[model samples]
Target: MESLQEKNRGYGSIFRNLNFFSIWIGQTISVVGDFLYIIALMWWVLEKTGSTAAMATVAICSSLPAIILGPFAGTYVDRVDKRRLLILMDLGRGVLIAVPGVLYFLNQLQVWHIFVIAAFLSSMSTFFNPALASFLPVIVNKEQLVRANSISQMSSNLSGIIGPALGGALVALFGAGTVMILDALSFFVSVIAIFLVRVKVEQVFPSEERKRFLQELMDGLNFIRKESGILGLVVLFSVLNFFVAPVGVLIPLMVKKILKMGAEGFGVLGSSISVGMVLGSLFLGMIGGVRRKGTFIMIGIVVAGSFLALFGVSESFWTSIFLLGGCGFGFSFANILVPVVFQSKIPHEKQGRVFGTLGTISGGLRPISLALVGVMGGLLHIQMIVFLSGVLVALGGLTGFLIPGIKKL
Candidate 1:
């Protein structure tokens, strides 16, 4: 009992730092804004086009730029000050979102306009993500990585739970444009929070013989290929994302068409998933860390895939909500473990590029999946398409078991 007590205390001490708390706060605020924007964006697109394909296209636009520019963004992240990179990314997104709002007020809003903005915002996000992944270690000790990630995940889930519901109400009362304004304001708040945190940014490669941008980009790709564990994880995530894409694209359709619900139903459904994610993150946080993370991740993926399949099969609104919520929980469980494993294993110098390359490839697969689902859902029944996606997701996890290294994560 005494030894167990000491172990728990030791683990708790790892996350007991001022810097980690500050960065965590900034990330939380940013996540809240992201969640709100997700609901607002989906609603706006759905209202305008009245098509699932259009909404999925919006999602594709938001993610494709990030995928295309991921390698370059990763290289750049390694070269620049991460804090400044984060601040600039937030500001860029804030300004871009404001453009759509201003257009709405001027009665110049168009579906294409939203798609373009989504692309630009996603492009900015491409840079932000790798930097944040690399920056977390600089601010927190390695021992606390899991805990920090768990806290971050929990906050993100909490935001997801609350943001969509609030965004729905705001959009219902005020307008989608007004919700955009709130999202923009949230970015400013995030920027200010990040600005207050002070940390020494470590240089990955000192100034000695600068290489061409293209050369540097290739270097990042090569790095991933050479690193077996990193490459394996990237491949796994890409597969997972491809299958999971349909879930995001179809949720709106499920609420609007299948469930015979409105935007408010969408909000409630989204919130239910968030609630489950929060629970999952909290469970991970309490555990602090685990041995054999790879096994845990595989189990999570299998569970998530099963839930997705179940969600598609069920017609009862309550049953769908529970299934989607379970999917969210399993998804977060796998997600939190993946990053922790990568951060723990990958060297600081190589993190940005590896994460970037991984982000690009994995992110790119999602949009293609979305487009496929959106188009297919139009022709086939939504439930059938969703069920197929769930099968793919399950297959992806089963494939992971075949890969010895990933099975061990």
Candidate 2:
């Protein structure tokens, strides 16, 4: 058992646990590479094809694997040696990512090549995510979950700050092929960090605990159906995501058409949101998060929507940046709290499936919503669409609170 002081240590205490820190640093580096590579890929594709279809293919290929494979990935995660799986996945992905960089260097890279790599990486991600999520609680003390997650979010957010700016600079100075090598190397770093962290026997499922894979998957869905709070939370996020997806497609248009901002100005707005995410993540990590988890989450939904709406209405370039920053801050709350609440509620054995299912439901709407919004933009004022979308999200996020038990958590 941990002492009061130990439990209260928050983010600072996470470093003292070398196991968590190693994975944290490794994963953060990996995230930086991911963003950097994405910018390089997008820019290269645009330069080559000059087609929106090629760009949209990137989004579709990236998401298709997750929507299709997440549940099975979660099921297997519950059955496997999670540490081994993480290491293997990292190794596999490192090799795969490097293939493209190598091909590009040889001047053999084609636009179709990007789509192939995206599909493979997306498939592997389904396994990597559930394995990592389920594995966290095994290594860190329960008291440290929130801080640990917050730190994780902080690192990823930090990469969002660094990745694009740095990627653009490096790609310009060096080239896409060279910058991609950096992404490949980050995985090696991740694998090394995972290797260093000792996986306790208790962390692995007992052989006797194994069940038929089909049953295991069903059990995961059953868990969600049985828990009203979890069900409500899932529904809240799904509805929120459905409404929020349109904003992603609309934001760039808003900046260009409504605010009369140039590409550089739009980029600045992105950086502001990333900055806010980093700050919000750090604040949560340092404070160890709020005790009234449910209430905080509810407030986050409203705040996110409120700020998003403000961004829609604001005429000043700087004002939009501030509101978007707030939107990012609110997202940090949702990102950190949703997982913590799930970890607290679900049994460890079932976490992979639950989180996987939750992730799919939450994320599945994105591609659909993006398409719907693009079509809707043709008929409605994009600004009106954005404002109404924000309104819906704010309303949907609050719906979880109306459930009887969620507020008490």
Candidate 3:
């Protein structure tokens, strides 16, 4: 057991756990590469095809795999050696991502090629994410979960700050092919770093106890159904995602049409959110464990929703930046701690399936929400849409308190 002193040792303490640190370093590097891939791929497709529909295909291909494969992928994750699965996923994605770059240099890359690769890579992610989540609790002490997750969130946020600007410069100087290759190399870095970490997993399910695969998947859903808090949390996130996902699409329209700001203003607004997330993550990590987890999560939801609402109404560019930043800060609490709660509440063996189901539900909402936002934007004012979404999000968060199961969590 971890002593009180060790448990209370703060964020720096997680770095001393070599396994967590190794995976952290690898993932941070990989996330930067991911951002590079996004920028390079999107820019290349749009530039080459000059078609918005072509660009939209990239989104559809990337997202469809998760909705299709999520449950089965989670079932596989629970049955496999996570470290080995993770390595394969990283290696496969690395190789797949390099294909476009290779083909580009050979003058053989096509729009269809990008579409296939994006789908394969997204399929790999369907496996990698739940495996990573399931693997974390096995490798570290329970006391370290929050700080560990916080540090993980912080690195991704930090990468968001650096990756695009860096990718844009590289794409300009060297071209998308070179950027894709760099992104592939980043995945290799992750593979090597993860390889160095040692994890000893105790098999909780005996061969005799193992059921058919479909039954196992059904069991996971059953667990969620029985656990009212988990069910409530999942629904809350699904609803919140439906309301918030369109903000990404809306922000550009807001800046261009409503705020009368340039591309620079759009960039600044995006960065403001990332910067706030970094600070929020850093703050949570440093604080270690938090009590009254339920209350904090609710407050986080309200704070984020309130700021987003304020941003919707604000005419001043600077004020919008500030509100978006606060919105990001408020989001961090729920983002980091909810997983911590899940890690504690769910049985280790079942985590992969449960997280996968939750992820699919949330991820599935994104495309639907974005599509609706397009239709709604045609009929309503963008500011009104933003304001209404924010209000609904806050109202959704407030419902958590009303649920006896979630309120007491």
Q: What is the lDDT of residue 224 in candidate 1?
A: 75
Which candidate gets the maximum TM-score versus the true structure? 1
Cand. 2 TM to true fold = 0.87
TM-score each candidate: 0.94, 0.87, 0.87
RMSD after CA superposition, every candidate: 2.5, 3.1, 3.2
Instruction: Candidate 1: give the clashing pairs.
Output: 293-409, 294-409
Residue-pair clash count for candidate 3: 0
List of clashing residue pairs for candidate 3: none
When 1 and 3 are scored with TM-score, the better candidate is 1
The local distance difference test score of each candidate is: 0.82, 0.79, 0.81
How accurate locally is residue 46 in candidate 1, as Cα lDDT from 0 to 100?
Answer: 82
* Cα lDDT of model 3 by residue, 24-103, tens digit: 99999999888777767866775687444465566667877987788888888888889999999999999999999999
Which digits, one per residue and each the tens of the lDDT, describe model 2 over residues 98-170? Answer: 9889999999999889989999999998899988988888888787788888888888888877886677667
Model 3 lDDT, residue 210, Cα = 86
